[model samples]
Target: MLAWTALLVAIVVSFRPTVPVIWGDTPPFVESALLTLETGRPTVAGGRDPGYPALLAVTVAFGGDLSTVVRLQQAAWAVLMLALAATAQTATRNAAGLVPIILVALYPGLLLFRHVLTADLLFAVFLNLAAAGLLVANCAGRTARCCAVAAAVLCAAVAACLRSQGMLVPIATVLVGACVARPDTPARVAVIALSVAAALALLAAGSRFGASDSDQSSTVFLPKTLFCNHLNIVLASDAARREIVSAAGDRADATMARLAADFAAEPGRWPVLGFFGDACLFDAALDRDVADDTGNAVGAASAYRSIFLAAVRDRPLAYAGKFVHQMAYGASVAWPPYGLEPAIPVSTDDVPLVSDIITRHGRAAEPIDLQGGPVRIGLLSDLPGISAYLFKALSTAFVIAVLFWAVTAVWRRRPEFSARAGIVVVMWAASIVTAAGAHTLDVWRYLVPAVPMVSLMLSLCAVELAACLRRD
Candidate 1:
């Protein structure tokens, strides 16, 4: 009862006095949602997954405001946190059980994200839910095990559908499940494999036949090609560039040569492309960029992949060096300075305080003013330096916790501990790898999914540390 009360209070405090913040990407999702509602078909375009827009469309259909949508997401997040708390309770035999829930309640990052307009919050919730399910399936009895496995597989599929990065989580979960299942329990292993396979089959079928759009060609290759171009033009070695140029068919080689020359003259564009996250180099002034044109996009993506592979084959040393550097930069402790905007949209301007977002890209200036309500916290905008310092501190603590868990889990040979911790470690590595490969290492938002895992692991490590000291 007390735990529930604390969680309720945290939700109220964190959300009181609605602050509606909107991002540049916010409009595309709104447009997609509104379009889907009008057309009565799921729509995905401009490099976005259809799941999020479909969700927003449902909210719109039900006469729900943005605040309403946010509230629902918050509720779902609360339930997930509660489930994690229950898992912790079971893991520790009801001792130190509330630690995970309390940590989640007070986690500023999660709380702040609870109101955002992106699918990231949903992705994080599902990731944690999947993790909780894994815990239950591994540690519970027969009836509970069957139900937990079903729930875990379902959560994994939903998470994957929400974001491209989430696609591998279900597979990872099944593999981890197999490893952790008792030697005598072949049934559990079979259940895990079947669940994952079924989910993947469903997702694939939906993508192939669910939408009515004739132009429903896959957009998966867009990110791959962009990552390759960013890497080849900016990070790859002279030998690698030559290899790429050699492999780039007649049409692309000339552009590649020009990009190589420009890179030699001005290497600063590398960071600009990395941090700002625009595929400026892929199109360049003289080259074509990937786009919605199905055939052209596919061809361009194929060419880019070929060149990247060629570079990797010819200059493995250089590719390795760049990979390490980019990953480190992406996962760095120093928070890039930016104001954390509230989740409220710009239409509500009557609130006591508000943040104005102006978009002027060679057109009439359009401004969105989001209400920040009566009380405003400027922790992200007003005190960026302090925020960065605090983030760095928290990040350092997370690293320590992960290291402790990794060392202890291995030394103890506990499959349960190893499976749970290993899943998180794998996801964390995947996030870094994706960011590094896509040249988004400088962006902080890419690492948000890893935050909850960090908190969960940290709490478990603390509990273990306390137990050890008591024994001593």
Candidate 2:
């Protein structure tokens, strides 16, 4: 299964440019990588975790090129697919479970991310790894089970170090373990206790690497500015807006409320929710006024956070409804939110540090947009397909698959199938909460992890159905 998946990934990824695909945010990772290479310390200024850069640094250490890194990432994705495939097979003792993983791997939308330079790819990879490993561990011998649990914990910890949402990975593991572990066994209790403690410790350590709420510079600052823009659109009542703003203590000012209103009123100037692109911190003058009151970005963000929390508290049910709606919206996207522009050859000549490192290492920075990049249609050249329609069919099929699995699992009395679905749901929830939790806007990119997660769940469902129909 692993060999076949790897072959499929390689063949599909061959259409990608020979160079490593680079995006706007790609250089900071290279910055961190070069720093790690020179100093033997994993650190960067842009609030990025060391996990990915550390991985890139290892490639540098081995004199491996960025193109190699791209292939490695693709391979990592293949491993994730195989893990889910293995999960399905192990759960039902049937090889038919490989179907869903293959279907996921063949999805055209996901191929875009395979060779892209982003930590999100790896973060998702480690998370699914933990989920599948934990499920498999449920069926393992005592010694192997302990090792598997330990490995899953390590994967969850690495996932945490990769993204801020990584804290959710630990929770998914715990839930998955609890679902599949035998209740009466003292070892199960011991395993749960040890994993919880380990998860808590890793959560503490990993969070220190993520961007802080107080951080008002770099990428972390945008959420505060964006909330006002979204609020102007979501909350129609002036009185309600005032009540939320008033929660900010001395930091709240009439100007801040007015600025938010003003930005929303402007027709073409500011984006409503920044669903396509953020950094819309909308109007500069608006945040400037808000910032002026608090005397600095930090103070302004603190105030904005207060307003954010207050708005949630004021209409908790409304917030929950919005969250669910946004999750559905994000999941329904068939294509990536970004990276579809006509591609130019990727280059780092403008970024001296990254350029120098690439020059020395002989790595090519290539651009990849599905429409015009070096990526060839290869096998997909025949018919231009609508991704939306494809996704609709897949989603409908997935629902049917789940219904089948639920019936079979109940009739056959299989706890493992239910456990598999539980973990998948938890993982999906984690992504939604992580992306939308900041009280900003939601975009398709934030839900990149869902592509594989949904596949894993679908695989379990399909596997369960196959197991039910087969007879000796």
Question: Over the full model, what C-alpha lDDT does candidate 1 score relative to the true structure?
Answer: 0.56
Q: What TM value does model 1 have?
A: 0.76
Candidate 2 per-residue lDDT, tens place, 255-300, comes to 5565555554635442224332232343444344444344666655
Root-mean-square deviation of Cα positions for candidate 2 versus the true structure, in angstroms? 5.6
Instruction: Tell me the tens digit of each residue's lDDT in model 1 across 163-235.
Output: 7666667776666555544425666556666776777765664232343332212333453435444554434
What are the TM-scores, per candidate, against the unseen true structure? Answer: 0.76, 0.75
Q: Which ten residues in a row have the lowest lDDT in candidate 2?
A: 375-384
Error of 2 at 56 (Å): 3.2
Off by over 4 Å in 2: 1-18, 32-50, 61-65, 182-203, 206-216, 219-279, 282-287, 292-294, 330-373, 377-388, 402-414, 439-442, 466-472
Model 2 steric clash pairs: 346-367
- The lDDT values for all models are 0.56, 0.59
Q: RMSD for each model, in Å, please?
A: 6.1, 5.6
The most accurate candidate by TM-score is 1
